[model samples]
Target chain A: MASNSDQQSMDVNYIARLARMNLDALEARQFQTQMDGIVDYVRQLSELDVEGVEPTAHAAPIQNVFREDLAQPGLTQEQALANAPAQSGGQFIVPKIVE
Target chain B: MSAARYEAVIGLEVHVQLKTRSKMFCGCATSFGAEPNTNVCPVCLGYPGTMPVMNREAIRLTVLSGLMLGCRINPRSKFDRKSYFYPDMPKNYQITQYDQPLCLGGGVEIEGASGLATVPLTRIHLEEDVAKNMHFATCSGVDFNRAGSPLMEIVSEPAMHTPEQAVAYLQGLKQTLMYAGVSDCNLEEGNMRCDVNVSLRPVGATALGTKAELKNLNSFKSVLLALRAEIGRQEQLLREGGRVVQETRRWDVEAGATFLMRTKEDAHDYRYFPEPDLMPVVLSEQQIAEWARGLPETPRQRRARFASEYSLPEYDARVLAADKAVGDYFEAAARGSKAPKIVSNWVMTEMLRRLGETGQEIAAVQITPAALAELVELTEAGAINSNTARELFGELFANGGSPRALVEARGLAQVSDSGALQALVDQAIRENAKSAEDFRGGKAVALKFLTGQVMRLSRGKANPQLAAQLLEERLKK
Candidate 1:
């Protein structure tokens, strides 16, 4: 379902706003070109001869992944906080979470 | 609207995090509420040159979910890599089940008129959860704590036709998972999240209409409200001869409405392929059956057993079995000391009220079922009057002491000694003469007030019924 070229740009910008992505002028112009390319690629995929081809959603060939329910030692606070950029009062601290 | 005027169709995808001790594909702990990213390792963090070793328990839990949901377990299933780029997704590709899922063609039974109605389950597959994304003004932060977590995604057929039916299906699914001990099913903690697919058609339409996907419904109540709002929006479009576009929407609980997010065409391509790092999983039927045998009694079966074995009312059985801890509490209390019905009363009324007031799940309760059973037994045996039992229950919850011990230590037990109660009743009659005369004249409430006075004289320990009888005999003379 392709829309008019001029109208599609407006819609895309609106969607970018809804997703809270602030695309600058240069990024918007680049995205317009990229969007057209992606639209063409998907259109080509739709044209492939597939009268009865089952759609594949996954690519991995693995099954039966699980773990036993047993008690195990967990990471200590010091070890857990080793990678943090900041820590305080035995808790990881970032900028205040909310106003 | 009348049933003949509209047709409603619904399908649900429920994501459940398995309650295993370790991650799905690694030995990293699966526990939640740890310091952020503490449990992560190279495998889970998607570090280069590291390969994932499939956890056997993750597979077992997936097959078990399929069995409990009434699905056909695929002896052979494969994991695929779903390609995506996001800050929370460090690898840019997630290991998941795609074409060949672990369980296919399964269904769960929901309560229907007369009995249980089996809802056809389309598929139950295994997947990995993404990391948490915290948005800032200029940038976004990522937490790898949830990344690589084991998730089972269950898809149901578009068979549910009403909001109530959708909620019931969700409840049933949660119950089955909890009963199998596969998950804790805590919605608030994001252990259970649901996405609903809803479509509307004409009253007699043979084929389904365009469907919209709604996401981020954190609670069961929100699911119902979101679906209802979507259904209403779709009906309005149809009645006005407008087209209903197939798209993904997000429910804003604060606004109480659904907002269009994006169309299907703009959706991510995913670029799914066989994960190069992991191997295909194969399970034996005997192996699956063993896991199935170990499953705890599912909520549906437990509800039926509670009704027939304990002779509990249908509503009581439903409420008691709503959660595993609540059901266990009822069973422990009813088994040895008090009758089932009496335990049900205190639990349904006082215990439930207190739990709700404190906003605590039965699992977090300090009062054990054994303690509650003793409390019920004390009240039923008249060892303590109803008021004293109520007071003692408050103390038991607050102090974490045994019900019997608290009653004994506080001297709150009923005074069954007839001589002691009658003397207090006599003292009460002598204290009030005109009110005693009025009791002889025919107002029965006056004697009730006098019984209260005698209870006060005994410091709230006198047997109320015996005190009332003694007061009536003395006033009649």
Candidate 2:
């Protein structure tokens, strides 16, 4: 796959627009060069074909993972709100939620 | 209009939140009243480096729920990732059962009003709940409290031909889950939610007509009403020769209309793939046996038992078994009182009425099952007259007092003494001489008047039957 690089050219701005992203002219021209190189590098990964191999989606080999219906200790009010940027009494204070 | 020629095809997908102590795939607590997000952990929050380990309680509950619904348990099952884009979704993908569900090919039996029928269940799968999203005008807020909760999604085949069957099927399913101790099944608290697929076709068409996905029906009444309104909407379109569009719609309870939400997009494919993070869920035969043996009799079986045990009418049995609290109370009282119909009557008429008046569930009632049994005993032994019993019932319901104590403390017990009642009967007959003469002249209604006078003389404490008997005896003299 890496040897057969036909050097196909495409418009980067067109792809960005389709993805609902706005890019300036200078940024588009610069990204066009960078993305083409990245795509070319990823194309090399196709050469190692293991057609029957399964795609791994997660890390753990464990299945049917579950916990019993037993209550456990939970965070205390002090610990729960320890990292809050703003706190009032026992609650984390935020902007008004209701209209 | 010419005899309408249309058929209503209905299918239901019910989501029941399983009563588990922890999240489906994490150790976060699955409690409702916990502070928002307090029960959450790194796994439920979808932290980048964290991985999920399924909760055993969730699996056991799922299998227990499947067996309760008469579904065949799948020996081999696995989880999949259903990808979607929503702010409420912490991982932008949900771990759910696909291809191989926990149970399949099961059904429920729901009785039609005029006859009996059965609804076929398509499948029951286990899944994790998404966080709750509250969309505001300018921004959206997400509550992670509900995230990672264990949810069992049961889909029914589109076998129902009428809206009434649909509602019955839903109610039966709710009661069944409740009996299994798998869920509270509270619609008000969002423990159970429904999405209905409805379509209307020509009278004899073999193929299904276009379907509209009705979303988020909050209550059972709303489910029935939404289905009815949707049926009308589809039939009118078909009659006008207009093709109904395949789309999703929201049921506007206030407007009583199904408004178009969105057209069916490229089939959500969800790009579902087996979750590699989890392993295959294999249940041992011994494990299943234990669960099955410990399983209590379902609502349907218990309903039949109640019918035979109490010799109650089918309607009364249904009302009694509608809620687990009421059904358990009825059984408890029946064992102590040995009068099923008598207990059923009190529960249905007096107990249910008080529950309604207070806007509380039967479990919320202050009166204990023992108190209820005692109350029935008092009534059966003629310790309290029927009228006095009704008045005492209110006191017991309001203040939660013992029936015997209330009767004695208030002097509300019936005066069954023949001497005392006979004296009152004589006084009534002498005071109402015209009524006495009318009774002798074959005016049968005059006896009822004398009976009423005797009751008034005893201040509603007189045994009504004894008063009537003694009054008739005095009139004859």
Interface Cα RMSD for all candidates?
A: 6.6, 7.0
Candidate 1 Cα errors over 4 Å, as ranges? A1-99, B1-4, B34-38, B47-49, B111-116, B204-206, B308-311, B427-459, B471-477
lDDT of 1 by residue, B109-171 (tens): 778665678788889999888877665664445566677788999999999999988998898
Q: Give, for candidate 2 chain A, the lowest lDDT window spanning 10 residues.
A: A1-10
Off by over 4 Å in 2: A1-99, B1-4, B308-315
Query: Which one is best on DockQ?
Result: 2
lDDT accuracy of residue B343 in candidate 1: 85
Give per-model TM-scores.
0.78, 0.85
lDDT digits (tens) for residues B1-477 of candidate 2: 235599999999999899987788777778887666577666776667778778787888888888988898998888998876555675868999988899987887788867667788889999999887565454455556688889999999999988788889988898888889999988879999999999988788889988999997999988999999999999888777788899888999999989987787633436577887788888878889988998978887888988887899998888888777889988887877766788889899999988888888777677777888888888889898888888877877887879998887888889999998988998998899999999999999998898899999999999988998888776666
**lDDT of candidate 1 over A41-61, digit per residue (tens):** 767776779888654333553
List, for all models, the DockQ compared with the true complex: 0.15, 0.22
lDDT of every predicted structure (CA atoms): 0.80, 0.82
